[model samples]
Target chain A: MRQNSHGPIGVFDSGVGGLTVLKSLMAHLPHESTVYLGDTARVPYGTKSGEVVTRYSLKNAEFLLEQGVKLLVVACNTASAVALPALEAALPIPVVGVIAPGARAALARTRGGGVGVIGTPGTIRSGAYQRALEAADAKVRVKSRACPLFVPLAEEGWTTGDVPLLTAREYLAEFAREGVDTLVLGCTHYPLLKGVIAEVVGPKVALVDSAEATAQAVAALLTERGGLASAGHAAPTHAYYVTDVPERFVEVGARFLGRPIPAAEQVDLTF
Target chain B: MRQNSHGPIGVFDSGVGGLTVLKSLMAHLPHESTVYLGDTARVPYGTKSGEVVTRYSLKNAEFLLEQGVKLLVVACNTASAVALPALEAALPIPVVGVIAPGARAALARTRGGGVGVIGTPGTIRSGAYQRALEAADAKVRVKSRACPLFVPLAEEGWTTGDVPLLTAREYLAEFAREGVDTLVLGCTHYPLLKGVIAEVVGPKVALVDSAEATAQAVAALLTERGGLASAGHAAPTHAYYVTDVPERFVEVGARFLGRPIPAAEQVDLTF
Candidate 1:
């Protein structure tokens, strides 16, 4: 296996929602050390504007960069939609965002060139997914909706229920009408709502999780760039850092990552 | 008014929640130009440890102070519980926290010296409210419970409904069992759940909103310091800055403030 001299891969989102993407990364790149940061102090980037999301994304990326990460992943839909271009341009390390990967995956799965996307208002408004799909194939018909409440609902652990299912139906009604064959869970947080969303969109529509796809993209990039962790490296270590309370991050993040999170350290990054 | 040539008022929270306190400040002190920063990009300070919350709180305050805020409001309950002392000592400006004011108000309202407090797990565990109430009057029996889901639920606008009411009941049952005559909405976000909480705890239990009480404290401080907005001044201007998207802030904020938020700007305050 090729070896990259640089340290851990840095992944961050507005909050714990990004754990979904981090989880996928852990699964795909089991030997790679990962540094995960959830701006648990200020989360839910989905509803923010492009400029603000960009700024926050930069800050988060900078924080991760400071931790000596070899690669950066903006594991957030809103950030990916609005900040990806600037982040990719500005960051020293290679940056991969969730949007394009998810879009690519959706394009591959869609049989009729019809795809659906759901994320925060900011992500949906940015039209990143539509543009990505179109860039891949102009013939593709893309439908997008902003499921703002889904982040909060999922964070609250309302993943499977009448209320979440009903909310999912209300938000995904447009895609259902447009008859998309594949749907992208545009926001990393949206993956938690996968069950309800899958139920609402029906079994015929393939669900694309950007987290999973982004992880694959990261793995591919690492393999190509000689950044893959050396074989026999004890199961890749995961360290969690948050701007807010670590206990809550552990509790909530455990649910998202499907396992216990090690104690998180709090850092004051105002310098 | 004998006002010092200080910069704008500095307000910081773990996340967008400080916006609620900022809204109240704008309403009460319109002429006072303000700079508001929601660590929206890294929120939910409620679940972190005291050391971490304090560290983040100091960083947040330092950021606002660097922007030249004359006074600082630790608008987050978890931060207030853990970081108030450190903030007051470290910052030059007078630092105010939500817990003391809200606890005082609840103590004032409780007829039987029985007070209930609800906040995030960190806040409840810190015993900030309990200490504040007891400090006001040792005879006051303080009952505290952590309502971890309330913040996410409130952020999602699930304030008043059968589901919210049921959740409130489940969380508030312990407090009700303690026979408290007054309840403190410890977290800034908890105010949004007032209706549901009121319904569960009954109208007889006075619901003390920390935001309102904190606003009153600001008013009193300004009056004493002769920094009150000119009496004849028109509505105080409000400017919002978040580390995340401004659109979501305005949308979720509108529900909290019960009015459409005026234009909010996105800012990069990585430091």
Candidate 2:
């Protein structure tokens, strides 16, 4: 991981949902410059066909590579499940996707050999989580469910209390029945729904947030590859760019990041 | 209103959430070209200060205007609620926001003169629906609630059945109590949750989908200005572009548009 001087880390997703990953990155690597691109114009990539997803992932990687990102984080579950290989193969930089990190974390946390993974339909359907978990340890049984509403609920800033709790109960009933001791919040957006999910899954099941795990992985990679930004820069400038209105990003993002996002630039991403 | 052959219809939002509006546009006005930009990298304009939302709205409008759009539609509720005046004043083309079309449709359908409005906190806080309803006719009593989770849930693709229904029940209880005759799905994403919302509100209260209303309004605007595409164009060309991964957009978008998205291109939107 030869570091490029002043090159920003490029992180991308279909929408601002990936802010969870970026937030984690910022917290862990305070000195690194970050450039985030959220395809707010066309988001929620968890349901497209494999071929289309691969193409889209390639395009996103291309855009980031164009920006000279020293590292690329596919902070989207759907892309990670379907397009990670293509992205890694196509890009010059190290490509990290959420699924592997999440799976790794789940494997580490599970005590009863029962691990439950919850995310979008595409993620669960791809069997990526199951395969990843099994790859780490063949004995671990992975119970997967698609908690689709959690992403939207998180986006709407519905993190706690009744509605999210109720929705969580509804979405996680199968997982609860499976009685997994460890649960993986497979989507980046799921971390926001932590309280509700934790309540629904009970105190016994350890919840693993993919965002946190992915961030940790990024830190390790940067450190190992000698790409970690050295300490002593002006608070690590975060430049936020989106294909839509910046206002909404700041508004919803504050809840996600737990701070005020100063300014975001609206850019035309039509190429 | 003057139709330009080369300019695309400039549609934007605070984030990818606006794709719901673009989905409607594509369905209703297939022949019309569109340039959609979602500030996905930064999003959730719903909770920002009014001044900030206004500034972001202006920037979004300006970006779209620069793209050479014949018309502009501010699809994000927060932006429409707080920044419509500025956007309209600054832009040369006719600017349409979700509030007016949604409010008008609610007014048209409400038999008891009680309309329920659901949107982001900023949209609800602005009392945009109340004002719009009052402007249409002072007699109409507007009952509004901030359904902050609905947007994220919609984005997560939890449009129907148990989880969304449960969430809707929690959010719409007040509206149901108010005995509203119509419920306005104020956020563009809210329409995706129409089934759950309708179930919660029951058959008596008609559900007004903003995307449909906005589509109708766009149709009316095009018809009135003779900007509607000629009928001879073969099924129209639909191009999708995003600042992030196109994979996630295609996946989440198919559900929004009710079909497979042809393809999405990724573009660098850093400014």
DockQ per candidate, 2 decimals: 0.33, 0.19
lDDT of 1 by residue, A1-271 (tens): 4435448999988878788898899889878888998876555567555776687678788888888899998888888888988998888888899888898899889899488888887899999999998999889988778776787677667788676777777678777777889988887787778898888888889998888889999999998988877868666678899876577788888888888986998765544
Residue A205 miss distance in model 2 (angstroms): 2.0
Regions more than 4 Å wrong, model 1: A1-10, A13-19, A22-42, A56-73, A91-94, A161-163, A173-179, A219-268, B1-44, B47-76, B156-166, B173-179, B218-268
Residue-level lDDT of model 2, residues A129-243, one tens digit each, is 8999888898898888887667766766668877778778877877777789999888778877888788888888999988888999999998888887777745567777776
Taken over the whole model, the C-alpha lDDT of each candidate is 0.79, 0.78
Error of 1 at B216 (Å): 4.0
Question: Per-residue lDDT for B65-141 in model 1, tens only?
Answer: 77777788888888889888898889777788998888888877989848888899889999988888888898887
TM-score of 1: 0.79
Docking class of 2: incorrect
